[model samples]
Target: MSRFPILPRHQSGFAYIAAVIFLVVIAGIAVVLLRLTETQQSTVNQALLASRASLAARGGIEWVFNNPVQRCSQAPLSTSNAAPAGAVNHLTDFRAESGFLVSVSCSFRAYNEGEAIDASGNSSPVVKRIYRIDAVACNGTANTCPDTGSVPRADYVERAQVATICLLTDGAPCV
Candidate 1:
């Protein structure tokens, strides 16, 4: 029998296959990372919008408080005599400054002003006036509710309300 010499096989094909597999894995990882980044960015944007909306609401409240003559009643009285009773009363008196939008509503209700309890187990009549302000900011071009985190369709409303309390005293600050 004649001994045959063994020849080494070329590994170029193996190298190519390994490189392709590596590239595929890298691509998959990159895609996953991109998706994660997108999600994070959306969340951050929503949060920012919400914060701005809240500030706008607060601004409305401040406006109402500052302009008591227009936003609130001259005298603290019961809700029955007022135009509208309860918290839902329409204020319809507010002004929006530049870069802000505001709407204000007010109503009067009789509440005990004194902290002490009377002998009849009832508190003294304070007759406080409550004002409600609904304000919103058109931040950017997005028209979606920040809380829901979804696209808003027709008839979708994105407004925030802030209620303020004021005493019956002269020049009393809103609580």
Candidate 2:
């Protein structure tokens, strides 16, 4: 109030402007961080689903190898997938947490005694059986189609595995 009189126009709101700018930068950084997190989460989810599908497919192949006699069973009834009286050769499904579906099929083909026989004329009786296994695993939750006994949709991830097994060795020369 003495001789020095400060004018209102001399005061500047530079501090307020700086503060607003800082806040805006912080908000942008937060948004970017959130986006990155979401992307990472999605990637992890896809990887886990793929692993589960692979395991499901592998399980089917293992089952066929473990049960060689079942592969020689009679053909399934045309009306139903149930085993023919005593044999058990059919498609089966397995899952870990219920969202995965693994379709497994076991089939067999017989080769002549000259197929893989050794040099001797006698063929080993133990080597009489051979079987093949095919397994396909996919995510059932992504399927929108009903169970019409057809193939799964293309959108769902799928894994396939195959294995051919021979039971024993033969002595007859195979040409």
Report the number of the highest-TM-score candidate: 2
lDDT of each: 0.52, 0.58
TM-score for candidate 1, residues paired by index: 0.59
Stretches of candidate 2 exceeding 4 Å from the true structure:
1-8, 72-93, 96-98, 113-130, 141-156, 168-175
**In candidate 2, which residue pairs get closer than 3 Å at backbone N, Cα or C atoms, i.e. clash?**
117-172, 118-171, 118-172
Residue 52's C-alpha lDDT in candidate 2? 80
**Which window of 10 residues has the lowest lDDT sum in candidate 1?**
86-95
**Residue 172 error for model 2, in Å?**
16
Backbone clashes under 3 angstroms, per model: 1, 3
Q: Write the per-residue lDDT of candidate 1 for residues 1-175, one digit (tens) a residue.
A: 5598777976568888999999999999999999999999977866765666567666656766677545555543443335443232222222223332344455544344555457999864444555444444433233321324423542222457656566553445545
Which ranges in model 1 have alpha carbons more than 4 Å from their true place?
Answer: 1-12, 73-100, 111-127, 132-159, 169-175
